[model samples]
Target: MNQKLLMAIYFYPRGGSSQVVRYLYQRLEKKWSSALYSGSLGNKGLLTNAETFYRPLNVKSLDYTTAHTAWQKGTNPFDTENPMQASLEDRINVPDTLMARLSPEQLAKQIQSWRHLFSKELLEPALAHLHHLTPMHNAVYELWKKTKIITHLHGTELKMIEYIRSNPKLPFGDWWIEKMIENANMSNLIITVSPHDRDLALELLSVPKHKVITIPNGVDIEIFKPTTLPDKVKMSYWKHWLVTDPQGWKPNHNPGTIRYTENDLKEFYNDDGSCAPILLFVGRFTTFKRINVLLDAYSIFKSHSKQNAPLIIWGGFPGEWEGEHPYEFARKRSIDGVFFSGWRGHDDLPLGLTSSNIFVAPSVREPFGQTYLEAMACALPVIATSTGGPASFINTEPGKKTGWLVNPDDPYSLANALQEAVEDQNLRETAGQNARDYIERMYSWDNIAEQFTSTYQYVLSHK
Candidate 1:
């Protein structure tokens, strides 16, 4: 039998990292047998089912709650010592009853205990049979000491550590930082999604430069490619997404609370009844994403521009946001021509991009703006901040520009870019085409998968 590749992550099918794992596994399955181990919140719907989310790939859910009980029962659930015929599902449970009641400190300790047991009982025994072990985050580095390990960073944990360090009053900040550094040091290879993150890992985690590799996130060009949807179909999409199946949540309100009326759709069309220019922003409403800053800039742009452009704020996980709720902020400022499309699955993003005119996200220090690539693939010109990953691709040159990269956190700069993009229809079309061409040539997921496979082979051969 071929040696199996073990992939582990602490999250379910939610973030960009999960998508990366899914895509890589799809491409690599032809080359090697693989199993994915991930955390489960117990929901058995299409969204939560590992088999459904990662179709045709072997998936194992590690219920830490069940593993915790098995630990107390004095029987190693992952033990191959007795050679029993128990299936992985038979040993795992859906609900984490004990974990739900724990305090923050207790929860941390419980996670640590689970990791220790997982490393010792499951990972250690499987090391000999495994050709490579890849974990999406560094928290599991200690688990694969005997195996060739590739540790991937998606930039959140590093940003958390940096924030914690800057604010020393944060509890256990120093200890967490030290633990992250130790994990990075122990890993055989470290891979981050952006060059900015690579530099941060080298500087903050103190990892050697040669040990780290920068692999930017990629998009599904096949899914996100530019195509014109019929007017009726496009309007139906906008209505269904904004009215029939609303997912936008207001601060301290449940999902779908922020619904749209017939009057709201008027702004989406021009005086001549044509589709108005639509500016889209997709991401979590986190502090660093600067959703409020984008709102401020949009308000400024609307005041100065003659065109009727509506800004569509597409995503924020239901009922979860930092600082002021975007809807409340908009209301307080009386900002018109701004619509919140709510949070939807990534599968629907192509429709959103294709139906829109431009993609704008004013996030400073964005780890890697994967949405920008997705939008670019759909031939939508991008407006992004200059500090992080988007800066690497978004060109600001006059005649040969793919998109605009403005100064981070500067509402005036973003507003200026918005004004320029909305006013010049020719510039928008040219930049959109250029954006599509660039992403096709460089950032397609097939190309990214090949790069990942080569890296895996290199690690396996060397180790």
Candidate 2:
């Protein structure tokens, strides 16, 4: 019989950690009897509802929809029956208020909610794999102290801590950071996505070197791999996503608040009437993502870009933003070629990557860029920065690279890279194929699942 295992995370299906849990559970389900405990944000039928996102898995969720709704109605989300979990970033207009901003009472509620989340499924599993260093970990320790736990840091927690270190007096950040360290110290093992992150975890969590492991995320190649859609089909998808069903939102507004006109589709073509090279960017509107810098670079590229070459910015979780909104930034600068796809489903991401000619997201120090790998799998040559997770993987070598690498946060460097990429179809096609090849050899989910199998085996055997 398969040994029982429990995996948990504090967030619902809103971010990378959620997908990591789902993908791992999908693969590990073959060898381990597993159940998921996640903090959820909506009713039963919605994607934020953990049961729905992790459907068919034995699931137990702490619904935050009521709490989130309360926040929407101008009440404190944290004071509701199920308080919204705090986030790594202190986002405005979102239920995930910054962790540092949480008051002492709110912090206790965060831990208690999570402590109670596993009230039933403290299912006596042989091992428990918990994602992040959230208050959830504190709760897990109290409830399942005997069950060996492996803590996985997806990078945001580290970022938040880094911010706290710089601003040590920032509210209750120091207290929370100490708890995160305590959680990390208690775990049997700590997992990070990139070598850089692995090293960072050691410094931030103050854990022994033996306790940390680096495991890059995996991609579902079957869904994300390169495809050649017919011309009409491509046009139909573009029109449908941009004109017919936009999800882009403005400050205080929800999805579909920034829909485009049907005439907007004309921007995808050159004056000569041929399809233009599409530059795609996908990520949330956080400061580190450098969407502002991308707009600056795209403006430089468009100044001389012969083809209309529209840059499609593909995600901005409605009403939630960390800095000058990318939309507002673009407006102030009078940049005309930028488009927003807003936030769409993960299944649609592959389609978006495949639809574009080149992919670029100049995130400074991404923990582990799963989207970059997914873009590579879709055969799109990417443009990444030399600073973070993508640096560890993307090769910009003359003959071997999957994509181009520009200096982080430098608009001129990115503009030059974008110009070179958009102008040469031959270069893009070659790099695209190389990207696909690299992902097949290095990032497939099956291959990654095997790594987890070995790691889990090691943890169990030592236990």
When summed lDDT is taken over every stretch of 10 residues in candidate 2, the lowest stretch is 117-126
Candidate 2 local lDDT, 186-274, one digit each (tens): 99999999998998998988999999999889998998999987656777788888889988887777788777887888888767766
Q: Highest lDDT, which number?
A: 2
**How far off is residue 378 in model 2, in Å?**
0.5
lDDT of each: 0.72, 0.85
lDDT (Cα, tens digit) per residue for candidate 1, span 1-463: 2355666666546566677777666776676656566654334555545555666667765443344345447654333221111111111222222111223454344345435535533324221211111222333444455566677788876776667666776455576567568767777788888888889889988988888998877888899999987767788898998888888888767779889986788888888998888899998777888999999999999889878998999988665566788889999999998888887877798899999999999888888888899999999999998898788778834566898888989999999999999889999989999999989999998899888778877776775
- Clashing residue pairs in candidate 2 are none
Question: How many clashes show up in model 2?
Answer: 0
Regions of model 1 farther than 4 Å from truth: 46-52, 63-145, 396-399
**Predictions: Cα RMSD each:** 7.0, 1.7
Worst ten-residue run, lDDT, model 1? 82-91
